[model samples]
Target: MHKRGQSFLGEVRDQIRSKEAKDFVSAELNHHLKAAKNKWIEKGMDETEAEEKAVVQMGSPITLGQKLNKLHRPKVDWLTVMLLVTTLGLGFLPILFMDADYYLQYNMDASSFSVQKVVFSLLGAVLAFCVMLVNYRRLESFGWLFYSIGVLILVLLQNSFDMINGVSILVIGPFTINSLSVMPFFLLAWASFFNHKKLKLWHLSLLFVCSFWLFVNTVNLPAIYIYTFMVFGLFLCSRFSRKIKWMITGGIMGSLLLLGFIVWPSLEMYQLVRLLAFVNPEQYAEGEGYMMLLLQDHISKAGWFGNALNSGTIPNVHTDFVFVGFTYYFGWLAACALFIVLALFIVRIIMIARNIHEPFGKLLLNGAVALYTVQLVSNVGMTFGLVPITTISLPFISYGLIPIVLNAFIVGVVLSVYRRKDLTSMRTFQPQQ
Candidate 1:
């Protein structure tokens, strides 16, 4: 056989070696080539000529191997899949407890709440699957569109409804839209547009104005903080220099301070009380501080291994303070285990983000990470009374639909990026003529 023919076949073998049945594949390939060579020789071709024709007839070795690679590759990230399933499963325990003690404790409709939660969870899972199937890069093209829509939603939400307990929930027909909960995702997705680019002063001004627009409409102070923090984190990860990052950081902090100053006097008495309670929960124990004080009392009772699934101990245990309730019911051991699993989950995401070579994908993952990590820290802080109580639900482990759905979608995006990380450049692999 000619050396070129041997090299061509060898390249094919190496490329397809990832296949499970590589040995059989290589053997069959070899047998077919040998038979072809023999036929060509009998047709009066020389050895080298027969070998060259056989290799050409087989087409480009690179293209063939890459095609086989795609077919044989396991694109699903099992680790993420397992983590998602396990986290969601554990999250249901709190809902179960809520259902069991509903009539006895809160006097709310437990069955209805449970049904709604289940339905949303299923819907979120479906959305996640759909997100995973879509190419993540295309999402960048729609970034501006999503941002515009999110902005429009925020405007409608702000103008359409009166404040309910200081925050507005926009009800458009049957769907309850917490524009605050869902709007940041659009911004995060749109961040791909600004990554690693030098923006003119006007561009920066536009962003600041847009962010300010969202900030003013947001009724929740803690959410404003989270949003600001996320934007700052994204800026830090941007292609800006250290000096620019510091400047942006300083600017953001100043803006937040100014915003707070502007809004502080306008805050509802209850909102003011809640903020003040963060300073002295003991002082407001019976009023705005009730939830914080209750969480502490429950944690004290928790000890190491919690006293079974007792209900009514922690108010609103199905949502905001689910972590505290979970710990109170299941004990510190369970809480610790949950924390460890969640930490591992974030770490896994960070690892994938680090490995991804694409700028936009990495930025998207970073945004997701920042969002999740901040929420995690804030929720845990609020649970233990280290931070001001906010409506931020614990990711995956909290009993809320919008947040759960959003979180699931973020995970799906990360998985999509991971699956296609290697395929980005090979989408249309072709050998030189």
Candidate 2:
């Protein structure tokens, strides 16, 4: 290459702060210079003269670099930020104003719970900001590593688990992390796998099989549902051929059917009853259907302005049953407003994903969308008795430290992706001699 073009690219690179952006800008400029030089040479100009002409045609390197720097600078989606703040505020309100008596059974008081909520909320915010500062593309290379780590965590939890209220938890010092907290890591890992250039159908099948095995060992139905949806969503968004996609889809469906057939009869009576309770809560109202019936009653009695019912009949009122408890206190009008906020937040994320040109970033965003959608639908559906009751908590609204922190990490990843959405260019340019 000519010294003039090399010097021009160097000057442009000096203006771009992001290393990734600089590489993209240099490649693009090099491609343009080569193309222009070729055109000049085609007109019978000497090769040296052609290179000089190409460099001159590029104009001032400083000015072009400045323009490119401005164009490729990292950006923040303020609307998403505002929506997150609003949701967190709404989540805090219920815990803040709940009757002090509710915490008594847990050997705590309302003030302490509020304090914990504030502390955890701040921690989550900091964690998210830290994640946002990172370049998400770098994570694409660690797909299998993350997957292995996630699997290891689950394995450890399985072998040394502590049962708290029928839920599996891992006790680390004073902290108790739920087994399902590993789902987000798996989500990222799967996204990386899907974005791999050498991805294959058998690789995905093995992943699914492994995930199913872990979920079965943990007996976490909600995690299984979320993982399945995420896998399917990522597969659809993958760059695989349509034929391979269909083949994998059919295989997954058939495997699920077969697994269900084999597992259904082996479920204990209580487990089977719990699975079928949502279909007819009235039938099992005294046992597995009791919570569903209670939730329905509370929701039905919640008028437009709410009944301000703080009777605390709903179990885990601040966690799994938060929405129901919130409705009983704040009424349907407030609930609808919360729903709208959540809907808009999700829609904003989808919009961000839509504008992303990078395939891996888009896959990560879509995977997040899939996970959030399932959780939102399932949690809300179970509250109204439309789906089976599980321990799934509403995202951002539930009062749990592990969940809030994990969700914040996801939000941070999304922010990181949006930050670089405009800086990456997928076009390949051959080197110019």
Q: Which candidate is the best by lDDT?
A: 2
lDDT of 2 by residue, 236-264 (tens): 98888899789877987898899999999
Q: State how far residue 425 of model 1 sits from its true place (Å).
A: 3.3
The numbered model that scores best in TM-score is 2
* Candidate 2, run of 10 with poorest lDDT: 424-433
True-vs-predicted CA distance for residue 40, candidate 2, Å: 6.1
lDDT of each: 0.73, 0.81
lDDT string for model 1 (337-424, tens) is: 9988877778988999888878888888887787778878998888888887788888887876777887788788878777767644
TM-score of each: 0.78, 0.90
How accurate locally is residue 17 in candidate 2, as Cα lDDT from 0 to 100? 86
How big is the RMSD of model 2? 3.1
Candidate 2, residue 407: Cα displacement in angstroms equals: 1.8
lDDT of 2 at 345: 56
